[model samples]
Target: MISEFRSFIAKGNVVDLAVGIIIGGAFTGIVNSLVNDVVMPFVGVIVGGIDFSNYFLPLTSAVTADTLEAARAQGAVFAYGKFITVIINFLILAWIIFLMVKGVNRIRAMEEKKPAEASPAPPPADVQLLTEIRDLLKTRA
Candidate 1:
């Protein structure tokens, strides 16, 4: 049973899945940074310099702060703008992956649809001579 489990774990599909998961986790961090550090700042400037990370309403009795952490410490239950930002990051990553997969599929489809490009065959000598004879015969006729 242990050997069977080891074989299952060591199979190509399992290894590919593991690698994909590791790469996906790393890609998530990159996308998160891009969204938070790059895209959001430009968006904030466009939207009148508003920071979405602190865009939360205070409802707890200790309403003495304007930050999400302070609101959370005061037992607030508002949806975090950071969480929404992360969700958008995930969506954009998924879209990029989808577009890449679509392009690969299109290339594969075109490859399949095309006829195999074979090298042109050399003309046989007998056929070439016959062509000359035919041309001469036509001129004589």
Candidate 2:
């Protein structure tokens, strides 16, 4: 059973999956940073400098707070602004993945479009025998 487990871990697919998971985690962090640090700032500027992260509605009158964090601390709050930011992040990440898949597909299409190299046809058996006989005769001469 241990040997089976070892073999399973040793398989190329498992290794590839592990590598992909690690890369995906790293890529997620990059995407999150791009959304939060870079993109959101520009978006905020365009949308009258209203910070989306702070946008929230307190569920209860007692939970009156200006910011999402403060509202959450007070009571349950509907954090729609944070949701919007997350939605935007998802959209950007999805768009990037779509572009990457499209590029790979385009490359695959180009490869498929290339004409295959045609191999030269072999001479007929009679012609081959005649050629061999001629070579023998030439050697004798």
Question: What TM-score, over all chains together, does every model reach?
Answer: 0.71, 0.76
lDDT values for all models: 0.84, 0.94
The TM-score obtained by model 1 is 0.71
Which stretches of candidate 2 lie above 4 Å from their native place? Answer: 115-141
Which run of 10 residues does model 2 get worst, by summed lDDT? 61-70
| lDDT for position 25 in model 1 | 92
Residue clash pairs of candidate 1: none
Residue 44, candidate 2: how far off, in angstroms? 1.8
Candidate number of the best TM-score: 2
**Model 2 Cα lDDT, one tens digit per residue, 1-141:** 999999999999999999999999999999999999999999999989978999888888889778787888899888999999999999999999999999999999999999988888999999999999999999999
RMSD of 2: 5.5
**What is the lDDT for 14 in model 2?**
100
